[model samples]
Target: MTVASAVPRLLIVAVSARRQDRRARLSQEIAGMIERLGGAFLKAGQLLATRVDLVGAELAAALGRLHDDVKPMSTRQALLTVTTAFETVPAGIEAAVWTPPVASGSIACVYRACHDGTDVALKVRRPDVARRFAADIAIVAFLTRAAAKLPMLRRVPLVEIADQVGMSLAAQLDFSREVEHLRRLRTDLADLPDIVVPAVLDELSSGGVIAMEYVHGLDRAAADKLPAETKEAGLSRLVGAVYHMLFVDGFIHVDLHQGNVYFRADGTVVILDAGFMFRLSDMARTRFTQFFAGMIRGDGEFCADILLSTVRHVEKGADVSAFRRDVTDLVARSTGAVAKDFELAAFSVELFDLQRRNRLFAESEFVFPLLCLLSLEGAVRRLHPLMDFQLEAAPHVMHGLLLTDAAVT
Candidate 1:
């Protein structure tokens, strides 16, 4: 009887090892497959990387490469896509000054054009990119349904999450939406003069092709070389602007990775790639604002309340009192670190893990912005780590909260 019991214990150990190895292999394969499955798969890889709590560290590590490493679509195909989008090369692009694509990616390529007597960046969608996005999203839907049957995974609103991913990708594939995103964000930042959102060249822009005035300047690499004082000031303005967008406007870019943002000599911050933007619902905005305020104040109880309100589908029979206690402890423990070497990026990662362990299901739309904030933190750290993001952001965030005082939960 003892020997038989030992056999089951050994088998359990063996099975766990096998599962770990299988997950590692699957993660690496997905890293490889994403490049081949270029369109929506590439986008989905980014979202998956953010959910280390759900997907595990091995998979997150593999999918992290999709950030800036995807294979660019060939130039020939990109030009053909542009031709398709415009029906024909317009007069200025047809002239002696058509430069090759300045940048290319799975969904689109950007070319510099002097069209309509204006220097512009013409963004052209990849051929059949929409169809590829649809296919990839279908696969996500299938997997979500299959996974939802499990008791642990069932806490996640898998179907709703998959639908959210699909909608985000669909919006991205529509270049027109990017123009609107740029326009709206520009308006939101009108009070902040140091921020430079691209000027949309409306007359030349169309469905799959958008022509925006091309502003030439330093990218992230050059920005890193700036004198410390200049970089710190610019970082402050950038952080403050982002806080305003997230809290006040409620519409913000979901992809603000270092490569997609740049800084100029005059301490002006320039941002690109507004295709993947997130708009918070009324409840999400209020909850997030409360949580952010609580974090800054080191108010554990307030944060716990907001955390519970923000998450969806809390498992039945869960100990609600215990959950609040755990969240409160997390906040209290982090207070010392926040006063010392507080990195919001790392904290967000920990928060995601905490929420997952506590069976709090945050939807993709909500989870994604936290990751976006993490990315912003990464970018800002590279620029100036010593700058106090909370101090810089407090004014904008407080103003936003006051405006929405009626919605506070």
Candidate 2:
């Protein structure tokens, strides 16, 4: 609207800017503003949470709760959504019905329903979420450009990174696209018995509604009192899946936080929410392989070079030498002369800190490193504490380094 009307919005943002020290207060205020604005702001809130490398742990943790899905509409709204997608809300509705949602979140919510004596999870996309998210994207892009004028953000390349954030959110909002992601991951891990992906009911899937084989397994909460060994087994399966994704297939499941990966009674790993999947480019994969190889051999210089090169793509005018030194020191502290003595999670946290310090934190597009590092390390610590992830991933890394004839261009 008019500049006179825009004054209030700018004033609110200015008020938020003034409270930099009170992170929680700032985060809540910003999240409220975004929620009220009702579109791109929510997406921006979620994106802000994912950047632990740039925002630091506390702020990131606070923003991480911004759900991507909107509050569910009334039964009338649900019927309208279904009717809009398919001429009627199904003629045989009396024969099969869905129960109210058991869990809800930012992008969509889950409801248990039955058809032909078989149970399924009906995930419905929030009406108007896409429109609202698109609005927030515009706002965030404007903010990113505005932020770039500052000296500190010049090191971080905020604008390009923000574009990445927008793309990631767009992918999440489209249920039809997400179904394809689930299908591809299912195909990739078909041979692996320990992992499970819900079977998509293609006939029932549309842009707004997705029906899939319901996972009848214990969530992390139900398994809380179980034996340490039980938890370890669950974690092991998760770690194995991540290892295969990051090292073997070069296809990553981008988001593997507790809720996304479930544990069956038999200890199988069922991965959900594949919207953020990422594939590594051949050249980037090669460089990462070199970086891992250097880590295995305890070669600081090679490791430093690889890390610096990775940053150069997403960040400009960064102090490569200083970043390299920081990485070298972290590697030295995290590992011993022998790779077997290393701890993956501890080492990963140190690297996360390094990214924040070097201003080479997570980018929306170039997010493979963060996904791989966090999921792999988190999975290892949760599963087999004794299994050295670095040592296990090292051999694969070394092989890639040896196989690729390309230089680090």
Candidate 3:
């Protein structure tokens, strides 16, 4: 069935599953439907998997399988795509030596190969994937616009969110831009020795194909079984690197799903797939930093003010005072809580709930950073449960705030 037809079925299923007990089964059913649809729908599932605040933890976990479990193109199909993209087979790489894909996703499948005596990972875009995504995005835009007409969703900025998703999907189609993202991230995280961003082979890469250094490392589950000290230090480095990206540099890798993050035996973190990324404006970055700084200090009013300043729209006759009070109370309750005690997913869900209740809509750009953090929180908690998130973020927040103040001066 087409997306337009499938959406109504989805809505019907949602309506039928109103009872709390059926939500888990409902989530699985919806995930299965999306998986069968494939293409942009599968990509959307992968993103929703990270958004526990919006969909709840159970549903998010159900959809998370879309990250790397999609069916891959056949070996011949994959080879043909690479050959077509290059106009001919690139030298030093033979088709016969190419093994089956090591990983597969909505847009591409990754194969392991050797180039110039160095092991490399070859990422080839699926045939007609771009055209399919374009068609799906158009349909999604129409659906979102229609959904926005409902009274309950009028303040949600559905159309804008759809546009952002479309832009990100389109960017991912261009392998060349991902190359730039990989290089920039490598430079940005250079100060952190434990972080690894693989090197891209420009000569072998193109708009549709990317060749990069092949990295072998343990997945999150395997890494969790490592020594306690090693795991702790690695988790610290990973979180610190993420903080550096958010606070020190405005650029961020928005997709930090389980499939993209790996850990070496020695505790080095390997970040793969630079397809989905965004750069925050200086103002947004500073505001985000200030907000976190306030959270660290247990200053609820300050945090509320920071949030208010970044809102894109405030509904007429909205209760701004009540919103402020709610935010204040939320921060107070979360004060001094560690990763184990304070769930970012739960906190974000409450915060977004408050925004919806108050008809306060934050700028999408500002909100995406929080979503990125939410995406990483699962790994953070799994690796180091007792981690003091606010405390860890304090230094980066202070540095970001100071840098912004100096720039103003």
Candidate 4:
């Protein structure tokens, strides 16, 4: 009788321990829930990671590392999704069929299949992804407006942030638009066969459904095994393509990290994810050009003036001086390293943690610029670990900055 009683108590303790473990995992769960909440949080996280000016450094770093990982539902759920979306089973219309996805992300899942004797990838957006985003956007917009009215948030300008978020999220939800964006990118880079954009089959594509040619390649980890020359060539292609996109084309891939980039067997670069591209406005471009030039020229004052003008400052009760100091320190650290042979190109999480503790910016306004800089940084690191950035990016940045001055003149 006592043993029986002890068994029940032990079971109770086990359940209690499980609950405690779950409670301890609450933070991770919240991060996941933030993503599942969709629209606002994902958009916000992306923006925050980019905006070293708004969300603080540590959070931005954390946000930057956040992936679009999602839990995949069953095949039955996928079938229901297709049936609800297009009023028919998508598998029937295609020349080939795909099983449920091998991988899933926040917005969509990718399935490998053969269609019309040609291999293709079937990308299906989660059924609730759109609806969830729509609802979240509304809530975010409302909150942004409310936040903007608050004295502390006026400088943050949540309303404007919301507008950017709303527009960006809306664009992401439209698969057709993504197809066109990819097509444009492909056309622009037609001369370069070292990169390939998957072709979207229009007949098989709908509002949230896209069928495209599958390009197989090695992820970053596997690519490390390749010969040094091939690796160099691959890195060159990736960097060159990105440089063209940002400096020459003026269209930026908002996300350009390793996972979004893949290496083919022939040493080509394959870019994925079309949902977060950014096209700079003329004025914004000019301002950024000036900023880049200022950095290239090592003109701190000029850069400061441009930054002050470019960023929306709080009307009052904010530490503008501290903000300036933070920016200066960041510039010094990041650029100073460019000139040093032994300096690491990578931005460590600790740097972000320090910045956050110091109360630096929090939003994603700076993501694109940082991305551009880091893309080059990453490329150089991959190709010539001993490279002097002054030799490579400075001239281009200087040249680009002159455009800003010319516009002002």
Candidate 5:
């Protein structure tokens, strides 16, 4: 069914599922609908899965299934798209040898192949995905514009949010951008011994295709079966690498979904899929690092002030002082808490809810970093539940501060 028709049905589902138990069923229905839509809608569902605050934890968990569970296109269609990606097919690789897609998502399908004795993975963009996504985005933008006219939605900046989501989705359509992101991540994390970013085969890659070294690491479930020490070590490397990206390099892989991360028996981590990445400006990076630093030191006032600095526009008559006080209290209470004790998801929900209640909307730049951490928390919790998040972040926070000071001097 078209989204236009689906909307009214979705509204009826929402109204009927007022009870908590029914909401879980509603979440599943919504996710199934998104999967059927299968373009920008799938991407949107994956993103919404990160915001446990905006969507309740149950719905967010339901939507999170969209990350890796979508059905794949047929082998025939996948092969055709790969062949069309290049003017001349690369030597030693033919349709007969190409295996059915080992992994699939809304935008692309990945097939495993061997070229010149080297195993490589071919990521081919789905046929007509760009046009489909564009059409879907246009529809969303139109709906958002119409919704913004209502008094309740007037304060939400729905049009701007829709535009940003559209641009981000559009960027993922260009495989060359993912190639660039993978290369940069490889360089940035080169110092970390246990982390792996697969090498891209530049000669075989194009706008619609990515040919990269085929990594054969275990998925999250398989990795969980490994020894406890191995899991902890691999997870530590993963967390540290993320810290380096956020605080040191300021370039982050925002999509840390289960499908994108893998682990090996030797405690090595393999990170894949760089299509959804974000970079922070130097100012934004410094401000966020400073905020974390303040949180570490239990200085709620400092953290509150840092958050205020990142606000794009404050609502008229907003109670700025009260907002500051509440933020400060939150930081104080959360100080020194370990991952098991302090859930970033819960903390973020409360923090964002406070901002919404106080009408203090921070810039997306600042919010994105927190979301990155929230996304990472899933893997972190599964791998190392007892980790002291604040304690672990101290060193990287210090390094970030040092970098900021050096820049000023």
Candidate 6:
């Protein structure tokens, strides 16, 4: 190639490398800052961990540490936040005995306490967190919009991702919403006895503080310490519940990492932190349910059609025919494959990549479903590597399909 023509390619490669390097530096900076800031910044860092498409893998990995490593606000601040949230001395909070925080995150700190003769957990939003989040998100929104115009970044919904994530973060400050999310999830998943969502104690809850049933359980690694059957059954139930939320109800618990949810001693799964959730559009719900069911049925063409339907915009001159063919082949290859070997998370990631490669930008709702799939995949893989995901998912997947059919009919 002539030097003049080669310059454009060279420039593109250099820009890509520069962007990658910048993301790396930013991720490292963010991780350190969250550790020190201990408020809304920490919450945003944890939220960013689920957004691999916009933040990229390196940044998300760095932010992942915030889930467990977030520092609690000072003891004085914790108590003051609780007091402020309640607008007075909350019930069961004697000035003499306020337990140190049992858990802490960007938006809130959790303490174990007694309320009205019952043991409970108190979740108090950090003082000034809402102000901090509002200011920071404005910066994030601006940056994402600027980044979205870049050739490499244009394939992702950078602005929408930032906006969706910002709104989710903001929602975390409202303990009332978290309370409602808990109650609704409990009601919806009541049929799944093996799954547990702690009961909300409404009497002690306010806009910034919530009191709920206290749950004692092993952390996520509990699977390693449990019986194989227990682990498998718990994970299977978890997947089924997530499918129902994502496809049927379109209400998703977006922040369901290891720290936020875990397994109890009896193998009942415990989900926590309803601060960041996703409510999908009517169209997204129908299409996502159909697409997921298609995958379970080993129908790639069907999956591809649904995938195409879900996306909001596609670049002109993109070879959509070739995209469909590639997806068809991807689906065809998975047919009759060993269930343990299917690796749904990896396949889903690849499918998303295929969309990116074809210049298809989807709505923000899509990201959470992908993250949810990966989380479920990790939970199952750790407990039972040899277990068949397809066989396990088939029942729930079929239920979603039936629901979708009924909705249409």
List TM-scores for all candidates, in order. 0.79, 0.72, 0.86, 0.67, 0.85, 0.81
| Model 3 lDDT per residue over 1-409, tens place | 5656777777777778767757887788778788777778887688677556567888977887778767787777776777776766676444522666778788898877777677788888888788888988888889899998998788777788779878887888888889999999989988788899888888888757888888886464556587988878877888888888899898988888877887777879888899888889898899889888889999999999998998977878888999999999999999889777887868877887788789897666766787688787866666687899889988888888888989999
Residue 70, candidate 1: alpha-carbon lDDT: 61
State which candidate, 3 or 5, has the greater lDDT: 3
List where candidate 6 sits over 4 angstroms from the true fold.
Answer: 1-34, 37-65, 94-97, 218-221, 333-349
Winner by TM-score between candidate 4 and candidate 2: 2
For candidate 3, list the clashing residue pairs, or say none: none
Off by over 4 Å in 3: 1-32, 47-65, 92-98, 218-220, 313-315
Candidate 2's displacement at residue 119, Å, is: 1.3
lDDT of model 1 at position 297: 80
Q: What is the C-alpha local distance difference test score of candidate 5?
A: 0.80
The list of candidate 1 runs beyond 4 A from truth reads 1-34, 44-76, 87-89, 94-98, 310-315, 336-364, 406-409
**Across residues 1-409, which tens digit of lDDT does each residue of candidate 2 receive?**
3334545755666565656556655555555555455554544455555445456667555654454234444566555455566644543331222446655556666667675677767777667677767876787789789988887556565677678757876778777778988898888778776889888988667657778888886364444455777767776666666656655556778666544666666767788877667777776666666666777677787787776666545455556667778888877776543223454445656765667566675323345555445544543443455766666666556545555753443
In the order shown, what is each candidate's alpha-carbon RMSD? 8.1, 6.8, 4.1, 8.3, 4.0, 7.8
Clashing pairs in 6: none
lDDT of 5 by residue, 351-406 (tens): 76677668886656755677678777766665687888877788988998999999
Tell me the tens digit of each residue's lDDT in model 4 across 120-193: 67777777677777877787788678776865444453566567747777787788788887778777666665
List the candidate 2 regions with Cα displacement exceeding 4 Å.
1-71, 88-98, 308-324, 336-365, 375-389, 395-409
| Rank ordering of all candidates by TM-score, starting from the highest | 3, 5, 6, 1, 2, 4
Name the best candidate (by lDDT): 3
| Candidate 6 displacement at residue 375 in angstroms | 3.0
Better of 3 and 4 by lDDT: 3
The predicted structure with the larger lDDT, 5 or 6, is 5
Q: What is the per-residue lDDT of model 1 for residues 287-343, given as tens digits with 9 covering 90 to 100?
A: 787777886787888988887776657766666677777778777766644212665
In model 2, state the lDDT of residue 356.
57
Residue 352 local lDDT, model 4: 36
Q: Which segments of candidate 4 are over 4 A away from where they belong?
A: 1-69, 80-98, 138-153, 191-193, 218-220, 223-233, 308-333, 339-392, 395-409
lDDT for residue 257 in candidate 4, whole number 0-100: 50
lDDT of each: 0.71, 0.63, 0.81, 0.58, 0.80, 0.71
